[model samples]
Target: MAAKSATKSVEQGRNLRPFYANHTPEQLKEALRRMWLVRRFEEMAEESYIRGLTHGTMHLSIGQEASAVGICLELTDKDYITSTHRGHGHCIGKGAEVKYMFAEFFGKEEGYCRGRGGSMHIADPATGNLGANGIVGGGLPLATGAALAIKKRGSKDVAVCFFGDGANNEGAFHESLNIAAVWKLPVIYVCENNQYGMSVSTERSTAVKDVATRAAAYNMPGVIVDGNSIADVNEAMTAAMERARNGEGPTLIECKTYRTRGHSRSDRNRYRSKEEIESWKGKDPIPAFEDELMALGILTQADVEGVRAGVEKDIQDGFDFATKGTNPEPSSLLRGVYTTGDAA
Candidate 1:
């Protein structure tokens, strides 16, 4: 009789290596950790909203972690990024402090906007995060202007604008792209194609199969990437960044991803079918990347768990900081609105 094996089957466990093979060990570890943080942070924001801890409407990026992290990884700290309303992932990727983000949502003194602009308006100018906008297609022009500034200053810095598929349908998208292309501005237009613009799917919204295809109109190269694959997204982003820095002008990258959560906290997401949501959920980026990394021998079960734990701790610390921080003074609220007073 043959003896039965005692070891656990690899099939029973997670494997996430291939997507991380191009990454150094530290980069792979940080990637895993950042994804975990983004997920956890979204959950926290959702919970806070439900508990009435956060003010204003909340938009959670539950399944769009890869697109944010992968693209932002290609940018330097000095580079700028304009984000959309559902931009927690982008804010985090661009190195915004989780604590300040939490404070921003809580409307506390420690918030990025000094308790003025809630979830959708989070920004850290010091980190080159211009701001996340409430209006669709609003940030596009701002990004173009920033690129112009970089050009005028003769700086190697680039500006990346993150927007939804809905924004592409706007005139600002077209106008900004045209001007940026004509001027050869250093900018990257990243369309986080979550297949939905609010409640409308891309099929119902746009006639084009790929949003990147529109880049051709402006004489720029447009590329489509599997937003679900962090590795591919990162590679595409790196190429785009290189093109921008070399003064070759902007590249339009449409990352085909899906958002599992509703458009906002009030949304029931009844517009989409359950089967559709399930289908997209199956292609979720985190687990998909885990499988790829394990295959490439870059991650093991323990590694994933450790990274998750670290993220949890950071999230908890952020919450603690937000809660412990003092609220801003009522009179001080009027300050910094228009001008800074001179001490003299």
Candidate 2:
């Protein structure tokens, strides 16, 4: 039987090469490794939350690894990205340290926010992650304002704002898009349409089936791609980033995927059925990619196991770092809050 990777794009016939044909073996390996890291990270986070290791309610992006990796891999570290509440994958994909992420989860002083912000407020400026927002559509204005600043400074840097399908309905989304469009700001609005928004399915709440359609109102390109297909998402992102960097304006990419976990710790998932969840589970991007790699002779069984072991070591190291790190001291809690004349 022919390998699936031997297949060509729908537009092209068998004459064209496979999707991974253009990518080096090393690149494919890293892609699979990165996706594995995200899956393991989310699973570990959920376990930590249940074990009372992480504070506050936790939102796990368990099934959405491909979407995050695909888009963020297209950008440079100098470019900025604003993230949503379920932003661990975004944060990690954008180059945030897993150790720091674990620190944040454990409320350690070494965390991105010194443990003050917790899960939703994770941000690392060094890596160009503006921050993750706890509020719905909260990061939209922040990302837009950052794009405005980049434009004002005449920098080629771009800003990517990651939001869910639910955030598209928010007022900030419309206002920010309008302003960004008027000025031709360098920003990419990525809507992670994972079927449901905290138990409220998009079919019932959204006006249009495709959230990309909303981009037309702002006079920009609106593209939709399979969120499960990393290559497809990357293709769309490459186009959007080109538009943003050329000062043409923003592009909204609608990535259709599913969130494997509940909305939060309190979620019972009474809204959805087991059959539907299992259907998505069967399409898990990580395993699918793995099988593709093996089928294409790009990865051996030993190579795959080595990657998994390496990822586990990294996760364990992060756990150890968080466990050994000092907790936030109450005395120094307010030190960074108020800016002093000499501090800046």
Candidate 3:
């Protein structure tokens, strides 16, 4: 299997096409920029938390940039997405502005959630990001429902659900997939298997060797891709989106990836070895993608450096916006707590 994969890689390199053949150079560059943004946003979020600028805990997707950007590359603002707790990347990939995201993190009223929902719950309706859930496997049913709604409305739009490996064992995962398959719902289930679920390794928790294999029971296509490779992820998502648009039910995609950071702010890095972390860092999605682009002559070193510089400015600007933004008023605490008007 390893030899076959090597051979395929060699062939792909020889044939090298832009991630999506039709994608323009600018679009490809934008994808790279988004990946960098996701990484930088998380880094800044962590720095802010350490500096006592933010109070609540947050999950970071620093090493998993390719999975988020690649999956969303094929989706438009009209398409929907349900994100997990570690969804900063998803928000950025779906086109949420970093300034608003930073504001939300800083608990400013100018946030996407009016400063109520912090890192784990940012939602932008304009971008079709239904919301990021704090509960485990929370987005599964939500995406399923969104896909059902799309079907009922007779629309070609599909809903993508991003969940972690831990969520795979949740009842919602099985229930949602079953219903989506039975009704031919246009939902794509993306499992970002970052090796460990919080601290527990999948080898110890999951019965199946690969999470995608579980989709077979639902009679849908199950695909596994190297989540570190943006092109690999984009190709898989493109196919899944195509299938969904063709009225061909839901598809399950498992991104074999790793997260370089600890699960949350409180984690002490006790469970995993330093060697494992270092190994994954070597496969860091941003540099890997940049290398691919350079190899293909899609971008020069100066172009890559320019993108990084632009991202640095964006991150700094977002930080400034968040810090200068107004805080949520204590007087309006109950504003969005309860639905006003006729409850009936």
**Each candidate's TM vs. the true structure?**
0.92, 0.91, 0.94
For candidate 3, lDDT tens digit of each residue in 143-181? 999999999999999999999999999999999999999
lDDT of 2 by residue, 1-344 (tens): 01123233123432323345545566667767788888888888888987887778878888888888878876677788999999998987786778888898899989888888889999999878988998999999999998999999998888999999999989999999999999999999999999898989999989998999999999999999989888788778878877998999999999999987889988999999999999999888888878877876778999999999999999999988988988866767566676773232
Candidate 2 structure lDDT:
0.84
Q: Model 1 off-target regions past 4 Å?
A: 1-22, 342-344
Residue 152 accuracy (lDDT) in model 3: 95
Q: Residue 189 in model 1: shift from native, Å?
A: 0.2
lDDT of 1 by residue, 136-212 (tens): 99999999999999999999889999999999999999999999999999999999999889988889999898999
Best by lDDT: 3
Worst 10 residues of 2 by lDDT: 1-10
Identify the superior model by TM-score, candidate 2 or candidate 3. Answer: 3
* Pairs in clash, predicted candidate 3: none
TM-score, candidate number 2 = 0.91
